[model samples]
Target: MVLQFTDVRNQSHIRCGLAPMEGVTCFATRLWFSLTSQPDFAMTPFLRVTKEYPWKRVSSMYAAEIFELKNAVSYKLIPQLMGTSPDDLERIATPLLSGAPFVDVNCGCPSPKVVGSRAGSGLLEDREVFAAFLEGLQQKLGHDKFSIKMRSGFLSESEFPALLDIASSIKMAQLTLHPRTRKDRYTGRANWDLIATASRECEFSVVGSGDIVDFNTLNTLKNFAPNVNTVIIGRGALRNPWIFEEIRSGKSVCISRNALLFSLATFALLHEFQAHNPLKLLELVKQGLFFTPCLTNENLWQALYSRLTTSFYGTEQPISHLCLDKPTFAKVKMIWHALRSGLGAQFMHPQLLRSRDFCEFEREFLNIAKDYNDLIPLKYHSEFDWIYSGEKRNEKQESE
Candidate 1:
């Protein structure tokens, strides 16, 4: 049941976890995921530390946020920090650990801003700095409470052996490897062969991450790489929140159209509570819908789109109208403000916009989802559109 990859290697049960995502995984997000499908562990988005800021106040604020909201969910929550300096690590570790039981150092983030700062994947490019940082953590926090989350390498597979060599000597609690170079940046295949090799060579417990969406894929990883004990899911979990529970149950995962719709509604409701401004909430809703699988079903997609627009605009207006006409940020903000002040209230579902308790909301939605699953045809009837297509979508559309 424990989330520690090393500790759970011999355990009879498997450990599934939610990976950290900036802007996407927040307090409300963690709660929604836990309620829908409990991942054994969850991590806060990587908190950036620099020579100027060094994450002093921001780290404490993050700690407080995690500590305050974690009680509402079941999973073990860990705070993740990103930095190149050992001093930054030494400074943030204690305050962060004060709020959560464990702190995960983020050495795997591939964002250009992070890499440009000589942190995240950039750390992989500097062996001496990375070693000093790890040694600093060991000296300050001890290996029992702190862990590292890293990629296979910075630019190539060459960095993996060197990283593992340094990592094996260090006494980290656990290590989660994403098995992709910084150059990969979520593009080609995940290189599970590298994962298997790392699992065999590394002395510490290693968790495999990248492209794990369902139980079948999880099983594939387990069978292919017996050494990897746990798996961390990122974008896959966001697309289908129920995946973790389905994997845990060892059942064939089937996400009904209604299920996807209900999850979207739940996300909007949850996000409303945590977001500071209406625009931020709208952005999150747009992002969530963009990632969700319901776009594959027209009925469900229309229902969600209607509900979402109505929730924001307080009317039955088409989203395309706004996207095509009122595309400016200021216009959208004005529309949101107008709706909040006047007519928007009447159109939104009273139960959702005015939802009080997350648990109660989740239960009610679960029932609605069950009804949809029973009433609708199990196979999605809609034609797949070009909106949710991948990187090659533009080229395909042009050719057509």
Candidate 2:
């Protein structure tokens, strides 16, 4: 489907999307964002298709909820699949295509487990293999039914041209580039220059992702890559849920504490129903929270608490009124952490993270909410130190 967002400032239109973030951008999260903000489209987290899992099982596990809520959302949601096998791709996508506008192929995930299977960004290591894989998918599921999301290259940026050439050769619906090599991971800045190049070189619609923190950054990107008409926001949206609204209005939109509390309650309740397992919910929360660890200049958690107390409801309504259990409550806290991370602030009370039960959590949360004032300006751009630890990068040497 053709999607576009109108920039009120310039009276220009461009497609803005919510980037597919594993664990974080689940169906419920997407739905929350769709209702709260305006993104032209949202991509589901990559659903890995493999022989180990039956097509029915995979569909029921991941795509089922999306199918059930397909009509409820105002924006378009494209299911993204990850697999090297054409048959697997066809099997999984066939059922989804019945409801989804189109599917997206994930070629950009840099996780070791994903790349280890010669899926995700690993496909970029071999041009012939990548070409054959795309060809097989096209032959199996028609060229128009799927799109591709990928990084610039596997190990270095130099391979981007050849990879783009191979992807553009296939007649897919659209192409989204993160512009960072697998080696770079989420560290450093995304190479917008590559996005400009892809926009100039490709026949299909090109989307630019990464480092889109706020309205200023979005404007800079549009000016830098004028031909690139589509952009995706992942981390930026987490920091400021009103980002899409801000982009459309061409101004900084401040999120109120009550709004934040309402959002947290909505997400916690939705996630609880979706996860269906407390342990699994815990794991998802940890995975989805913050991508990097750094010190900040502001007390984000206290500010949120302060804002909540002074809102229309006043102190009479506790956050625990949402009736979330300990696990779901933990998920809410992690969501706050993610919001805090992007705002360039820190969670002041580390003890909150150690709360063992719902009673303890509610008590501590209420205490924090009692003291602060109503208005705390949520800032998007702040000092962030990107740490490049954990994930093992591809060892292949870059070619000259």
Reference-based lDDT, each prediction:
0.62, 0.69
> Which segments of candidate 1 are over 4 A away from where they belong?
1-12, 54-56, 59-66, 255-259, 276-400
Across 85-195, the per-residue lDDT of candidate 1 in tens digits comes to 667666877776676656788988888988898888888988888888788878888765678899889999788889888887888777888988998787655778877
Best by TM-score: 2
lDDT of candidate 1 at residue 74, scale 0 to 100: 55
Each prediction's number of clashing residue pairs:
1, 0
lDDT (10s digit) by residue, model 2, range 1-400: 4445443533236667789988778766775675456577788899888976664746343553346544444567778999989998888889888887569999999999999999999999999999999999889989678888999999999899899899888888888999899988887678999999888988878889998877788989998899988889988887777677667766666544445555555566556555565343333333432111111112443343334333323453455554556766776776665565543333345665677644465566556555445544455744432312222343222211
Per-candidate TM vs. native? 0.68, 0.80
CA error at residue 337 for candidate 2, angstroms: 1.6
Winner by lDDT: 2
What's the lDDT for candidate 2?
0.69
